[model samples]
Target: MTIRVVVADDQELVRSGFGMILEAQPDIEVVAEAGDGEAAVAAVREHAPDVALLDIRMPVLDGLAAARRICAGSRCKVVMLTTFDLDEYVYEALYAGASGFLLKDVRRDDLVHAVRVVAAGDALLAPAVTRRLVADLVRRRRAEAATEATPDRLAVLTAREVETLRMLARGLSNAEIATTLFVSEHTVKTHVSNVLGKLGLRDRVQAVICAYETGLVTPGAP
Candidate 1:
């Protein structure tokens, strides 16, 4: 099946660049292009593409807002774009339900692969960019703890789950976790899915944030 895509960016050049890269893939097709967030939302509603490639900064509406609406309204996967490796909006985008987060200058292969990942209903966030997302979540979690009551989800995780999650949040893929725990990859996937379901998280990205929020994994710590 062809993976229909919508490219949204403030700059025509960037949008064209991304659309060009994606169109080259035999399994990919560009269904629409939007120059702003509002337009992006409209395009999704109009095209109902399989994946939406959105830029973080746009006039009238930003990618985060657009992603929120798009994800809520449709089953289409959202992939947020950033110029910098560490974007302040990256954390917000994850919480907004983006299926993937990618840098603006991503390689052709990476961009193409990211689209396929999202289309497959699997999420992806560049490991380098995950640092900022985790850091931001940790900070917000501390603030929330000071204000609201403790989240019950934090207690829902079992000890074994906590261990699996910490490794996952640290950017270890399923294969790596399976090796570390001496378990099969299928077992690791099951544990990860259970963690997300119990916590009501959308995907592994939120699971990553949860790991940091609960202090299960410290950023940059061995």
Candidate 2:
């Protein structure tokens, strides 16, 4: 299946460069290009692309706001782009339902791989980056009463599934979780799927956020 994508950025060079890189892939197609947030959302609606690559600081709407709208209204997945790996922006983007993010200077192969990862209905945030983003979000809310992961909600998960989620929240990939649990990667994938379904999460990114928000895992806690 071809993964249709929309590349949105204020910079003409960035837009063109990404389009060129992505279109070079056999399974990936650059369906549209947008210069700002509003056009990005519009392009997604029109093209119904599998993924939307948006610059975090676009004029008119910004990536966070665009991501919220796109995730809320369409089936398209969002990948935010930025020059900085700032925790604040990443945290906000995750909460806004971004599947992941990419740096403006991303390598060609990495950029193509990110779109494929998200297009396959999986999250794509780097483990280290995700950890920092989660920690930042949790720290900002530390003063407020912690909201435990809903027990009734978690009740649907089997013990193995719960363990899978914990591993996922710890930033372990399916293969890593499989190695830790001494199971096949395919089995781990099944468990991860179960965890997402039971939690009603859109993807692994949301699952990780849910785990943190519900206090199933704590930032920097060993």
Candidate 3:
């Protein structure tokens, strides 16, 4: 199936450059392009694309707000774009229901792959980037006493499902989780799906956040 996408950015060159790269792919199509957040939301509404690549900072609406609107109003998956790996807004974007994020200078192959992954209903939870960003956000929240552990929220999960969520929060892939549990990757995927379904999460990104918020996983812990 073709993965229709909307590339949104304030920079005309960057927007067109990404569109060109994605348009080059056979399975990926740049259905629309937006120069700002409002247009991005509008494009998603109109195109009903599989994915929406939105810049974190844009004129008017901003990516976080746009992401929330798109996520709440449509089935399009959102992947935030930022110039910095440690952009503070990334955490909020994820909470706003973004599938994940990519740096502005992402390589062509990775960019294409990210669109495909998110379009396939997976999160762009790269171990190095996602872990660090989430850890930092958790730390800040902890310091401010803003995070209250709600262990009861995970009551619907089985013990094994909870373990799967912890491994996911640690940035382990399905295969990695399978290896640790001596189970097949298919089993890992099942557990992940059940976890998400039981917890009412959008994707693995939200599962990871839920694990942290529920105290199933702790920042800087193995």
Could you give candidate 2's per-residue lDDT for residues 142-195 as a string of tens digits? 546455433556778899998888888887878888999999999998998888
Error of 3 at 163 (Å): 1.2
Pairs in steric clash, model 1: none
Model 2 stretches astray by more than 4 angstroms: 146-153
After the best TM-score superposition of candidate 2, give how far the Cα of residue 35 lies from its true spot, in angstroms: 0.5
TM agreement with the true structure for every prediction: 0.88, 0.91, 0.94
List model 3 lDDT by residue over 40-143, tens digit each.
99999899999999999999999999999999999899999999988889989988899999999899999999999999888988747787777777666667
Best TM-score among the predictions, by candidate number:
3
Which should have the higher lDDT, number 1 or number 2? 2
- Best model number under lDDT: 3
lDDT agreement of model 1 with the native: 0.84
TM-score for candidate 2, residues paired by index: 0.91
Compose the digit string of candidate 1's lDDT tens values, residues 132-199.
66666678768877766655566887877888888877778888889999999899888888898898
Higher-ranked by TM-score: 1 or 3: 3
Candidate 2 has its poorest 10 consecutive residues by lDDT at 143-152
